[model samples]
Target: MVGTAAQHFVAVHGVGHGAWVYYKVKPRMEAAGVRFTPVSLAAAGNNGKKLEEVRSLHDYTTPLLEVLAAVPAGEKVVLVGHSGGGYPAAYAMEKFPEKISVAVFVNALMPDTKNRPSYVIDEYLARTPPEAWMDTQFPTYGDPPITALVVGPKFISDSLYNLSPVEDQALGHLSVRPGSLFMEDLATMDKFSDDKFGSVRRAYIVAADDKTIPAEFQRWLIENNPVAEVKEIKGADHMPMFTQPDALCKCLLEIAQKHAA
Candidate 1:
């Protein structure tokens, strides 16, 4: 259990997911005296913006940046990034290292400071070919052809929500939106610096049974971008908050106690 000092946690959802995905996590963390804030990036969750409106990486990360900017000067918050949310989390760490106590990548992409921000995602796509996506649509938009991923119900059920509850799977099907990879923008942007992003503490929570990002690939990510520590949740699918909420909470609480103290 965490000490009397309350730890603040800001959760960033992955592609197609909104802040609503953290509904199960919020109460559990808050009950343990942690301040939990889940944010919806542009066009995600209930955000009014259309996918077409999000033109660049900066636009997609604006909400998260705003939230970090609002944090008290002396205090820091734990930033939890799930799946593709890792991109913005890394971005935040670079932009506001002092405001973040630690960054936790939960079955998510963990980019290294040595390469462009797009490198990790590009690697991920290379590993997961179009055929492997299985019904998940990759539609390109705009003049330069920015690609957006629309996760299909079949893919969500078979991969993302395999171990989650029926109700949760239903919720995901109804709420998910098209999410951009912003590959073009990231490819041109500068790489993260060791002085900023690397200075912040990082921990990874691996969902052992995650089929979306297979165990082997997850290990590959860890090997490439080593974190301060690595924790695993046995039998957890991609959406651990739904399938393994208690276990996820335990890992998060332990991380908070160790890293945020």
Candidate 2:
């Protein structure tokens, strides 16, 4: 029931990234008269929480859930999740379906109600083996051994920011933080429901040239859990906000118009 003037876009970043990932697209979205809010997940970006502090999926998703909880009555937000960020976004969608106009997964791990929340992450890991992680670091913390992935410069350059500018690539190398998939917590968590998460409209944006989550895997995600619409950013890599901001912004604006309004 969001009014046309109340169109809001909430962006959720992927692993090892924070709200900063959407810096390139934020201005563009706002210029189009859309309110854009980019959130920093626990331990990511400038968030003070340490990697060990975010032990579970709930811990990591607190910020986003809080944001949705604060939305005014009768207003809704267009939630966009990129990369591994789709997990938290999906969790929020399940928790606050009425607050979201649509859930857009941009080359992200979109989940289904049939499987555990971690299924998409498990499938992604299976598709991309540990060896494929390249120099990415997997550091464990806490008594239970919570693991977090710190993207290495090589991995950033080759897989994530391949199509981005050298400056933006360097920015990613400098600012990216350790992020956990929280697979254990997700495995134990209840599955998303058709009435909650499924009630919200869903869309997928394919980053065509992404090496991190290849086009094939992206397609597989779509095939597995169908969405209301599928959008593609041709020649874009995993970091489409940096590599193809114009196209990414265009798609988002159009999506907001169609779905949020």
Candidate 3:
């Protein structure tokens, strides 16, 4: 077991999921002697909040920010983000960079300062819902000014999880909901840009067979941020919590240890 700067691991899950989805990883981290703090975004997880209420990147990140602010002074944390959750993690880095000791992008968008989280959705927009349904229905569920139906969770293709086990695949199915806007406002924050991220010590865990975010894209993200370190988890799907707990645990611990050192 490795000790982290703080006992807790603050995690934000990908689309359709709240903090509960991290249960598998949470216990493993705790058994290994690290602490875990899993939270839900406004409309995420079992928070029971309606999907439409969480319409913007900031609304989704407010819970995470509250947690970061509560951390013990002088204590640092490694923020772990999965899939769409990257938007909030990136924002957290911007609002409170000092609270984050490191960032781990897990099959999620890795946006540097200049790049927008919206770009992640842009890559898939063409394949998402037809314009009519998206343009009309989404606005009813999600307010305007948000890129909900098309860019947020709506555009995720089932192919992203071709490698996961049956159970995780189902959970992914259940958690699906359109995010308010696909990219995050955090991308616009002063210190969260490409040059700034390059200055922070970062690390990434690349899923060997992730189609959701692609190994190539993960590599591209790491390459763009010069300060980041990379580790490969073999035979892992995009959702490591379900498909590869042990390997994911090892990666998490290794990341924690490096930052701890």
C-alpha lDDT of candidate 1 relative to the true structure: 0.90
Q: How many pairs collide in each candidate, listed in order? A: 0, 0, 6
Q: Report lDDT (Cα) of residue 252, candidate 2.
A: 80
What are the per-residue Cα lDDT tens digits for candidate 3 across 6-58?
Answer: 45678898765678778788888888888778878767777667766665677
Best model number under TM-score: 1
User: How do the candidates rank by lDDT, highest first?
Assistant: 1, 2, 3
CA-lDDT, candidates in order:
0.90, 0.89, 0.67
Cα RMSD (Å) per model? 1.1, 2.1, 4.3
Off by over 4 Å in 3: 4-6, 116-145, 149-158, 181-199
lDDT at position 79, candidate 2: 97
Alpha-carbon shift of residue 11 in model 1 (angstroms): 0.4
Assess the local accuracy of residue 11 in candidate 1 as a C-alpha lDDT between 0 and 100: 94
Which stretches of model 1 miss by more than 4 angstroms? 2-4
lDDT of 1 by residue, 1-261 (tens): 542346889999999899999999888888878788999999999888998889897899899999999998999999999999988899899999999988999999888998888898888888886776888988998887888999999999988999989999999999999998788899999999999999999999999999898877888999998988899999899998999887888898898788887
